[model samples]
Target: MKYQGSCHCGQVAYEVDGQLDGAMACNCSICQRKGSLMWFVPRDQLTLLTPESQMATYTFNKHVIQHHFCPTCGIHPFGEGSDPKGNRMAAVNVRCLEGIDLEAVPVKHFDGRAL
Candidate 1:
């Protein structure tokens, strides 16, 4: 399914083609703090609808994930990272997606904090 999302201040926007049934709640420090439920999709499945300058990238720890956010509102609508096999992917924040039923999607718990 196709979905549209944006940062809280509307400075950053994107369109993604994916499903919500597989959304996840990761226990990583950043994930826990942000409280964003994520869904992974191929990089090609997501398109940024906003100007590149409107978004800022942040990376920490191993510096693998490129965490993108709106500098204006500090809202992280999505992030980009590679899987173990080196395939690029997008980790979309399901909460940012439009018209999604939060209750209908099953949230998987990932022990990212333990990694």
Candidate 2:
């Protein structure tokens, strides 16, 4: 399935093709702080609908994930990284997706902090 997402201020937008069935909540420092439920997909499955200049990238710790957020609204709609197998991947913030019923989705908790 395809979904549309954007930052709170609408400065950053994107489209992602994937199923949200495996949405996850990571316990890592950043994910824990943001409280975002993410859906993982291949990098090629995500398309930025807005200009890159409108977003800011953040990295820390292992710095494997490029957390992209809207500087204006400070909303992290999505992030990019490579999987353990070195395959390009993207983490889509399910909260940012349009018409998403977050209450209905079961979130799988990932113990990223332990890694």
- Backbone collisions counted per model: 0, 0
> Model 2: clashing residue pairs?
none
Q: Write candidate 2's Cα lDDT for 4-115 as tens digits.
A: 9999999999999887886899998899999999998999999999999989999998788999999998999999999889999999999999999998989998998998
lDDT of 1: 0.93
TM-scores, all candidates, are 0.96, 0.96
Q: Please write out the lDDT profile of model 1 over residues 1-115, one tens digit for every residue.
A: 8999999989999999876667999989899999999999989999999898999999999999999999999999999999889999999999998898888889899999899
How many pairs of residues collide in model 2?
0
The Cα error of candidate 1 at residue 61, in Å, is: 0.4
Which 10 consecutive residues of model 1 have the lowest summed lDDT?
17-26
Residue runs of model 1 more than 4 Å from their true location after superposition:
none
